[model samples]
Target: MMGTSGGSEEIIILSDDEDDKDTSCLIVEVEAVKKTVGVLPVSPQDEDLVVTFSRRPDVLPHARYDCPIHPFMPTDCERTAPMANNELICDQCFCYICDKLASLCGMWCCSGACHCNSHNKSDFWNDVRNTALLGELQRFNLTLSEVDHHLRNADTMLQSFRDELSALFSSIPLDQAMLPDYNINQQDLSSRYGPVLECVTLFLNKADKKNSRAAAIMHLGAAEEFMRHFQVLGFMGSSSAATTSETIIMLLHRVISSVQRRIVMGDITPLFMQKLQTFYQNRICFPADMRPLKNRFKCFIFGRNLSPVFCSLTIRPWQDVLLVSVLKGQNVSGFRKDKGKKDILFETISVVLLRTELLQLQSRYRELCRYLRVVLTDNTTLYQHLQDLIPFFKCKLGEFGSALESLFPPASPPASRFTPPIFLLYLRIFETATAPRLTVSQPEQLCFSGASWEPIKDAVPLKRSELVKFALKAQRCSLPVGSDPQCWASLLKVVCSPHGSPTALPVPSQQFLHESRDAVIDLLNQQGYNIQISRCFLKTYPDQALLLLVTGALGVRILQGSFSPALPVLHAYKDNLWAFQWLCEGMTSSEDRLKSFLKEITQESSNT
Candidate 1:
């Protein structure tokens, strides 16, 4: 109960006695119950008012709540119901208090001043509300921390490749002029050159005859494998360019020494052995070319110059010949200009001198046609003829004119790489006849869309090569996947850029930057990376833009809550992944620190 007048005043209550002398008025002096000193004098009425209604009708509104002129608790006087369980509460300020003290004091008065003018605590409402809000806050903070950490982690990952390439380039001294233009670390030298050289040494030593001879014989294959490996590692030059091999240099000398030693010993077979070794040397040394010389020494040990047995048009054992004898009597007349000069097409039998190996010939011929197709820009008819030429290379040049007319069909557009002829070739080369095509039941499944992943359902049966092609297509980048070109370009941009900053890429023209940036983004996105780029990305700095774009996109995606684990993508591009560390050398101190800082941020962010 609160009095209408302010300040510490006694309340006068009129008794309900029916005596003649008027009901004796009772004056009640409300004193502070607590004996604590220095208690400030407080007004009986509080400023803040809270009127609460009871669910039960038995509970009446206090009399102090009613007043004339200053009605409705003056719309400001503090008023509140007792606490739950019927605990005593201050009539002026709704603070909970002991029930026994409330009865003794005549009103539910708490220790706090009744007329205190201050704000009220509004935090607690319901247990459910409190729990829900707290939990949500915690979750939001955690997610933010996780996102921050992942973004940095992605930056570090991108920088790692850069670092690797840098380290590699640094290992070679400036004075080393004899080294290749693109020499990796000494380890690469050891990795590619070591095994072969070790084998060569064994071949040279007569005391180690068992190991040496075995290693020499196996050296050819090992050298080939390592050459391909180094090439994949971005160590080799172009396919057409010749690279000096340490193993080959040592092996040639070793062969010469062996020849000299055998000649001194008066060995009868020394000359023949020298010739055979020379042929093997030539085969290993030359790059693959559309020349019959490469295949001449393929089976040199079996005697390449045994005899020239001509079947029809002087087809020799030494010549790259594919003998075609049709059961039906028919003359081979439809001759390509290039084919006419290379082979003789006669009736009943056609002796085609294929300059390359069976598989190599097909590949070279197809590549030549493709190159010409792109160059001429009107080789649709020529391309169709080339498609038919695959079977023709295998000596099935039957009904050539009809086959060409049917395959070409006059004015039809040039067929895509997905044409039946190419697909059939891929099936023949890469897929086994006994193996079933991949389906939903297959072990490996490619992801095209992140939201809804389904097994690629093909109308025709799917070969492994087709699956590979589809996977590449799903990535949506013109850049070669899991290849050295991608790896080399990825690293080069960072290293070659100004002060090793991706954003500091040099642009030839300012106008091309925005267009190039979008293109770079699209390329990276196709490779399943989301990145951000400034409008300064230019076609001139594509390599730099690519590096920055991928790194930026990865960070953006990670921070924006669409992060997929990077390890899998890195693994898919393992060759490129391994190249990252060397690439990092081009980075500035800040960039290097940024990578380390990101690692620390993840930890600190999680703690927060």
Candidate 2:
């Protein structure tokens, strides 16, 4: 029995196997194996590695050598062996060094060596254990280093993918002139974007394999955002082409989504078309097998914001198909939940207004108001004048007018009237593409920064009202003098257009009026614009004449200059007529162009 050097346990070998019994013998076999395999040299620390084992003190004396009597010597030559007294018995003729089993053999000890050439037993035994442990540790470190390398590579790939995605978005062709010549081939787009998406998918797979929860979630979100850009591009394409059916468009979207799922879930071995075909067929039918896949796709696309998804899923497919079939000349159904034509018309107008009118007002008004506020607050004289034109209180008494009237009585002195110079400044700044910087006569001599209000003011206007009246009565079609601008400018155009029915506009009454007001308010809120001030103004002045006047003045300044003392304002009126005519010119042309495409589609479907 031998004890391990570390004192963990006693190794008792009762086997008849000679090679296994001796630790030195095992070490010799290991060295031979190393020579056969040709492994690299281990760490420098392993150079001194030694295997060690302890022997029982009681068995030390009984140690004996297994050597045959030399043929050259007489049979009388004695051998070392264990004695009946359990002790080593060596004859006088035998080598003294050979008598000690644990000692190094000398020249006289069995002709300088025993059966084993290794003379130092301690070094042999220690090396055996040390080499085994070192081999295992080397393997563990190798694996760890490989994983680290993989993660680093993935990070680099992710960054490259992000850069490519940015380039794709920034290069989108928005101009109509560029669209026909745009050279981003569909096939090339697919080829370029595929690898970028796959890199992200691969990173996600690796993260999942490593059980990195945070990394997996982050990559998943990034990939989703990446796909969102494509989705928006798809919408813009549909609007531009107007050839693809909604079904085909939706399926294409699903195809991309399906690719993401397959890649991330480790199932993307098939060809691209094969996967797309499978998803397309499966989605159109909604097979039981594909239900889970569809649900997962929805979950990823919408995350927890599932209102639209839930609504879409719950609605019957036949109903959607039926509505599409019927909408040759009619408005699209299944878009909004409203059942009445009047309500749907109002809702559609609300959506258009939010996107166009309210957005323009909120952005332009906020900027103009901020600068005006700073200017007015700094100079009381300017403030007093501006307040007179705008009225700090009220001009008339109505439902909510009495309170406003009390705040600013008509009988009071005219301290609030705006001077023509400052009023013209206010008008000209908004009218031009670039608002000029002002040096206000205040204590600080503040120089306000210029803002570009072109996006709002420079947009094409809808002039169907003038167009219709011009066709009906040529000489009488001029814009009325001293008239407030239309508040429902967009809707008025839609209703007055040749294609639109005059009856679509709701009759003016308490109910219809209240509904229109609510619709406007709701649209403003939905667009993330604060309508509290607008709402109060609308309620206080139900005619919307004041609101119209303010916007009309801005519009008129864009065409005809107001009376500011600045040179820019003085020169603006000469250019205003041309500018207004140009802005209004596109309205009819754009409507006609859009209608051409829409009518083609509707007519073809209706005929079918």
Per-residue CA lDDT of model 2 for 52-104, tens digit only, reads 98773332242223222211221122224222322222332232234334333
Q: After best superposition, candidate 2 residue 106: deviation in angstroms?
A: 73
Off by more than 4 A, model 2: 1-293, 296-320, 330-567, 575-608
Model 1, 384-484: lDDT tens digits are 44443332222122222232232222333121223322333322322221222211110111111232312222223333223233323312222222222
TM-score, every prediction = 0.17, 0.16
lDDT of 1 at 513: 39
**Candidate lDDT values, in order:** 0.32, 0.32
The residue ranges of model 1 lying beyond 4 angstroms of the native Cα positions read 1-354, 357-544, 549-608
Best by TM-score: 1
Worst 10 contiguous positions by lDDT, candidate 1:
439-448
Native-vs-model 2 lDDT?
0.32
Q: Over all chains combined, what TM-score does candidate 1 have?
A: 0.17
